[model samples]
Target: MNVLNTDVLVIGSGPSGLAAALEAHRNGANTVIVDSFARAGGQYWMQSKYGLERNDRQMQAGANFITNSENLGIKTITDAEVWGILPKYRVFIQQGSRDSIEITARALVICTGAHDFVMPFTGWTLPGVMTAGAGQRYVKMYGKPPGDKIVLAGSGVFLWAVAATIVKAGGKLEAMVESSSNQFRLFSLIGRHPSRWTETRRLLSPVLRSGVQRLNGYRIDYAQGEDRIEAVKLRQVSNSDRDASQELEMETDCLLVSHGFRPITEITALLRCEHQFDTKKGGWYCKTDPETGATSIDNVYAAGEVTGVTGAQSALIEGALAGLGVSEKLGFTRNGIERKRARLMKRQLRTARFADGLAELFELNTNSMPRIDDNTLVCRCEDVIWGDVLKSWDDGAQNLQAVKYWTRLGMGRCQGRICGVAVSRLLANQFDLDPRIFGFNHPRLPLRPVTVNVVHDALARKSL
Candidate 1:
């Protein structure tokens, strides 16, 4: 087991973590930033070459700011996955399958960001069905086209970005979908739905700029084809309309879906950090102060989507805030830094407010969330299917935790990091639990996976 020490350890190399690293280094704290991805740009940089990719001039500057190790003392590690966190500030990590390292840090900054939601629908398991993020991944990371004909569906700017990328890549946009049904429905609901309308405008502004045709208030019935998705069948959902007024079918090879993001809290959950189910952020967000990004644990701060599902800008701001707070906590910064910190925090607040509005409108539909079909696999890690959980539910499993236990749904290596949130709701709906009792099945620690040699050597060190 190799051991290294740092004043502060920042996990993730996204916009926020980069900001945190720069702040930590500038304040004279020795810091190391780590990410699982092969590249430093997190999703944005990794996805930059895509047709709809971002320019990210600010993030580019931040990255450049932190690259000077002699100036800022920022050390970045890529392709590293943290497996576990111990109470004594020992982080067990696997750099790869055979190699392992343990690092003890005075403070920890988590900026591990969020995951886009994949609400299950019929034929969602088909090969052509993918998240808009996946489509972006195809474009930017893989430099490949999902298909020549793509239908970008779902609400929010991300889906629109995908549409733009596809069309810009010369892929045909068979259709672009939004849950909001019709123009008349907006007028009818205007008096009673002012907040919704405001959110609509903020979210739709980016979508409209993409020049994608809209299919409002449509629910996809399923995709057609035996092995691959040939086309999608969508039916108009009720908005202000009293009935399902119209049905539309579009020809496309790929159908992209995105319902927004969930805070990726697997490592934090492993640390046993206090959590709150914030539907606004789309998943279990760490309990942290709005000012400092400090969580329940002392000297361990969570920034970016690891704390909650805010976008890149919010992540950048919160990462900087957490980095600043770490400086103050570690006694690294001199006087007068708070003024600069306060200014940045205020800017972050504005973005956070905008994020609040964006988060609400693009959230996964409550009615469309239960994705387990009789044959559809729910826990990919364990190969558990809907029928398995349904059988467990039939046997009087009343809560998500219960279904998990009976089916071992989250007992796999990924430890339900991916499917736990979706399954929690499915159990709640099936068992008729007051939706309120949908308990958290958050991840557990030895946060990083370890091999026998690493564990044996670590236990040997404990003997010393």
Candidate 2:
């Protein structure tokens, strides 16, 4: 095992991680970044492997930022997944087909980003059904459309961005179905942030020009397919009615869906940091100081979506603040650090307000839970259906762990990352209780699945 040391270790390479690394390096800390992807940029700024022309604003910005990091001599470990963290800020990583390496750092900055929040429906496990984030990555990073014909259905502005990307990739978009009926709320949000209008137009124009059907106040009732998705059934949704009888069936080879994003907080949770549940902030998120981005634990900080899903703009600012905080803690504060921190703090306030409105505008509709039948699979990894969970409840299972023990709901390769919240919502809607009462699935070591040899090698170095 190769052992390394750094003054600061940043886990993730997205906007927040890059910004944090840049700030820490400039402040005289030997900062290092590690990402699970093949390249440095994360989902928001995923780089194309085909050397595709850089036309989009995000791509160009990501390219420039990555270049700056390299020019500044910031060390980044690509294709490395941090599977475990030990006492004294010792991190263990597993790279592809290589022996695991351990890095001991003085301080740690966690910026692990978020993933799509998807609900289960009939035929959701079909071959052609996937989350919008997956579809975007397929098109943007791999330069391949998910399917020849795609129908995007979900709540939130992210669908529009995916639709634009599909259109750009020359994929035929059948329609875009949004669950939120309150377009006025979205317009009002954009109205306040005038700078967003340009981005709004940029994402929406291509989809509209292609004449894709845009349906608001609609939700996917279920998907229809054999082995793969060939069509989808969508029903009208409204606050007053909850479920309207009117339904629309669309033919498409692919169905991309996402209710919203859920923050990836396994690292923070594993470290025993304080967390608070807020749906608007993307479920359970790490609690951090607004001024410094410091978590409850000493020498550890969290930023970006791990703190909350506030988009890239806020992540960048929060990352900088966390970097500055770490530098100050390590007694390496540079001149004028306070002034820079003040400016970032003010900008974060504005972005946080916008994030609040965005969350409200695209809030998931709990009423739709009733439409999912008993046979629908809630935990895709474990193949646990809603009926199984209900049966567990009837058998005296009151909380998440009891249900898991009875039905094997959250014990899979994903380790409840995908199915924990979905099952919680199912039980809450059925029993009319708070979702938090079920609590969250406790995170265990080796956060992601790794080869047995990798774990053995890591353990051979030191007792974790």
Candidate 3:
């Protein structure tokens, strides 16, 4: 086995990872960055090639910030998917071509960001149906169009930005269904986080000009078609409390659905770090001191979406804080930049947490998902269905763990990374309750998919 040593390894090349690496490098600590995607910007730059007319600036900023940081001694590992973290800060990374790497660092910053939350529908498995992130990536990175005529259906800032991207890509948007509880309620919060106003103005600028029709109070009922998505049905959502009413249905060829993102906290949970199940941040977010971004695990710091889904702004600040803390802990701060970086990071932290109303709307609730029948497919990777989960419930499967075993639900190539929340919604549907009342089974670590060979190698070299 080969070994690569660094003073700090910051995972994920998005805004957060970029800031962290920049801070660490500026503080005179050796730092490397990695992400599964090919480029530096995560969502900001790559959401859609036809981003909102105004999004170009931010994406450019993110790209420049990261590339510049990389040029200044930040090692970058593009197209690398990390498998797991060993006990002694060894990060096992698997590149896209299946080549593996073992990265041993004195401190680890988990800037691995969040993914879009998908609650399945009858025809959601169809071709035209995808998460908002996927739809954006189709145009942004791959140079493909979402479709000629499309409907952007979901909540949060990403949905609006994606809608604009579609319009800018020369694709016609038929409708946009928003699940934001009430944008008016948080009007006061916008002041606290000044940066949000800037981001919001930028994201919404293009969509407003695109002339895409806005469907204010409707949720996607299902995508209906045989081979691929040909039409989407929508129900008029009632006031914030209940599901959509069956009066309204939008006739369209494609439906892009995403209600923001939940925390990718499975690996964090596996570490047995203390977590507080805040229904506000979508799912369970890591409970860390806001200042250091340090979790309960010693020398194991989390940044970006793995800690919580606070958008690019929050991720950058948190990553910088973690980077400073890690450098100080590892004695890389002989130049006194740690104190300065920490102060700057803390100031930016408050700027990012500004009145994010998306947090209130997108909670871990089965009620938010489109109606699921007993035969509906819940786990896309393993082909597990609602019937299988319900059958487990019928056989006395009480909690999420029992649900997982009875249906072999979470056992798959990607593990339960994607479908964990969807299955939780299915289980909560079995009993009539909000998913927050009882969330998914506590996330066990080794968050990414790992092979036996990687484990053996990591264990053999754990003493670094």
In lDDT terms, which candidate is top? Answer: 2
lDDT of 2 at 201: 93
Cα lDDT tens digits for candidate 3, 269-381: 66566766654565777777677778888877788777777777678777777777777777766566646766766676475455245576444344345766777788888
Q: Please report, as a residue range, the 10-residue window in candidate 3 with the lowest summed lDDT.
A: 46-55
The CA lDDT of each predicted structure is 0.71, 0.87, 0.71
Model 3's number of clashes is 4
- Count of clashing residue pairs in every prediction: 8, 0, 4
Evaluation by lDDT, superior candidate among 1 and 2: 2
The residue-level lDDT of candidate 1 at 418 comes to 62
Q: Which stretches of candidate 1 lie over 4 Å from their true place?
A: 47-71, 167-172, 181-212, 239-245, 367-372, 429-436, 446-464
Better of 1 and 2 by TM-score: 2
* lDDT, residue 393, model 2: 90
Query: Which clashing pairs does model 1 show?
Result: 82-448, 83-446, 83-447, 83-448, 84-446, 84-447, 84-448, 180-217
Provide TM-scores for the models: 0.85, 0.97, 0.88
Give lDDT tens digits, candidate 2, residues 77-118: 999999899877999999876768799999999999998888
The number of the candidate with the highest TM-score is 2
